[model samples]
Target chain A: EAGVAQSPRYKIIEKRQSVAFWCNPISGHATLYWYQQILGQGPKLLIQFQNNGVVDDSQLPKDRFSAERLKGVDSTLKIQPAKLEDSAVYLCASSSQGMTEAFFGQGTRLTVV
Target chain B: DQQVKQNSPSLSVQEGRISILNCDYTNSMFDYFLWYKKYPAEGPTFLISISSIKDKNEDGRFTVFLNKSAKHLSLHIVPSQPGDSAVYFCAAIWSNDYKLSFGAGTTVTVRA
Candidate 1:
């Protein structure tokens, strides 16, 4: 079975610039999540979607970050006016409904200078 | 606030020895706990998990123990191998929202 897929494994941008990351979840998965892992820290939940509808996004930076899952299969996370602290590995994961464990992608490493 | 915490930043053990990593959580609502392993430049992979209903769950050489009263959980790896060298993270989720909360992580190294 294919695991979650994410494009642009690495990205470099300047502070105040905008950047976007994309992810394709496993087939038939109904739940998708985006997480951010800063250096020496664990992945922190940024947002979650349940079939095109947002389930949770309390930790998301409303002013600078946004994400959407179109048609409930693929997702895109965007950050505008990126800051130096925003530099981190953005990971995408997915799981079937009612399942506890999730499958994760290799992740996109973003570097904001 | 960070709910789950792995206080030990790093641990080193001899090959074939035992490795124990600890985690503590602040949220009582969190009923499910999980462990994930990550290599440099790679995303975390699910390792093992334990539910609130049970005190212990074992998977092959890996075992997880949960103490509800203390809100603490631990992972034990017996006969650790060199391949087990990586950063280990502890995560928690409350059934209500299913949002995962994670700790900073504990780096483990196994020497040959």
Candidate 2:
């Protein structure tokens, strides 16, 4: 079985520019999550989706960040007017329904200058 | 207001020694705890976990102990090997939701 897959392993953008990252989760996994990991810090949950429906997004910056899991298999996370603080690794993970363990993808490293 | 914290930024241990990593959380509602290991430029991989109801969970050489009353947890790796060197993160999930809150990771170096 394949693990979660993500595109554009690294990205560099200027402040005020927009950036997007894509994720394809493991087959049969119903729970998908996006997380932001800053240098020297642990990953922080940005949003979570369960079968195309958002389960939680309390930490997401509504004004600048948005994500969608259309069709419930692949997902995309976007950030507009990126700030310096937004430079971090964006990780995508998936888990089986009601499962505690999450399988993660190689993250997209975004650098906003 | 960081809900989870890993006070030690790094630890160094000789190969065959024990490596203990600590974590503490402020949210009492968190019932599920997990540990993840990550190498440079890679996403974190699930390591071991312990639920709130259990005081300890062991898997091979990895053991996790949870202290619900103190809202603290620790991971112990016995007979550490050079291959075990990596950044370890402690994460918690609230009982009401699946969202995971994580602490700053601790980098462990098991030197030969």
Candidate 3:
């Protein structure tokens, strides 16, 4: 079985510039998630989608970050006016069900200059 | 508030020894706990998991022990191999929620 897939394993952008990361989860998986992992810290949940509907996004910074999973198969996360503090690895994961083990993709490491 | 905590940032053990990593969580609502191993430049992969009702669960050389009363859990790797040297993260989730709360990982190095 194939694992979760993400694009542009690495990215760099200047401060205040906009950047976007894409993710394609495992086939047949209904639950998708986005997380941010800063250096020396664990992955922090940014948002969660259950079949194209948001399950939770309380931690998401609406002022700068946004994500969507349309059609429930693929998702995208975007950050506008990126800040230096936003430099981190953005991970995408999917699970067969809400309570199952999640499989993660090789994250997109964003470096804001 | 940090819901999950992994106190040890790093650990080094000689090959063939046992490597123990600890984690504590403040949320009692979490019913499912999991361990994930990650290599540099790679995303974390699920290693093992245990439910709240079970005190222990084992898979191959990896074992997960849960102490509900203490809100503590641990992962044990026996006969640690160089390949086992990596960052290990502990995560938890409530049955009703799809989101997972993760602990700052513990990096384990097995010296040959």
Candidate 4:
């Protein structure tokens, strides 16, 4: 079975610029998630979508970050006015409904200079 | 606040020795625990997991032990292999929620 897929394995943007990351979840998976992993830290939940509707986004920094899962199969995470602190790996994960374990993608390494 | 904690930033062990990584969580609401392994430039992959109803779960050469009262969990890799050298993260989920809370992670280096 194919795993979750993400685009632009690496990205570099200047501070205050806008950047977007894309993700395509495993086929038939209904739950999708976006996470941020800073250096030396675990992946922190940014947002979760269960069939195109948000399940949780309490940890998301709404002021600068936004994400959407259109049609519940693919997702996009965007950051506007990116700051140096936004430099990190953006990971996309997905799991089938009623499952606890999630499958991950290679992730996009974003560096905001 | 960081609810889940993996105090040991790194561990090194002989190739044939056992490797134990520890994790603790302050949230009593967490009911399910999991371990994920990650290589450089790759996203984390699920390794093993344990539910609150059980104290231990084993898969192949990997084992997960959970101590509910202590709110602590551990992962054991038997006869560690060179390929086992990677960052291991502990994650938890609470009742009625699917969002996972993760620990900082432990980097294990298995030496040949």
Q: Model 2, range B1-112, lDDT digits (tens) per residue?
A: 6899999999999999999999999999888999999999999999999999999999999999999999999999998999999999999987566778889999999999
lDDT score for residue A69 of model 1:
99
Candidate 1: share of reference interface contacts reproduced: 0.67
The lDDT, on a scale of 0 to 1, for candidate 4 is 0.95
What C-alpha lDDT do the candidate models reach, one value each? 0.94, 0.94, 0.95, 0.95
Q: Provide DockQ values for all models, in the order shown.
A: 0.76, 0.76, 0.84, 0.79
Clashing pairs in 1: none
Candidate 2, DockQ score (0 to 1):
0.76
What is the Å distance of residue B34 in model 4 from its true position? 0.6
> Regarding TM-score, does 2 or 3 come out ahead?
3
Candidate 2 local lDDT, A74-94, one digit each (tens): 999999989999999999999
A1-113 per-residue lDDT for model 3 (tens digits): 88899999999999999999999999999999999999999999999999999999999999999999989999999999899999999999999885558999999999999
Provide chain B TM-scores across all predictions.
Answer: 0.99, 0.98, 0.99, 0.98
Can you list the residue pairs that collide in candidate 2?
A: none
RMSD of 2: 1.1
Error of 1 at A37 (Å): 0.7
Please report the candidate that would top DockQ against the real structure.
Answer: 3
What digit string (tens of lDDT, one per residue) describes model 1 on residues B1-112?
A: 9889999999999999999999999999998999999999787899999999999999999999999999999999998999999999999988777778899999999999
Error of 3 at B10 (Å): 0.5
Candidate whose TM-score is highest: 3
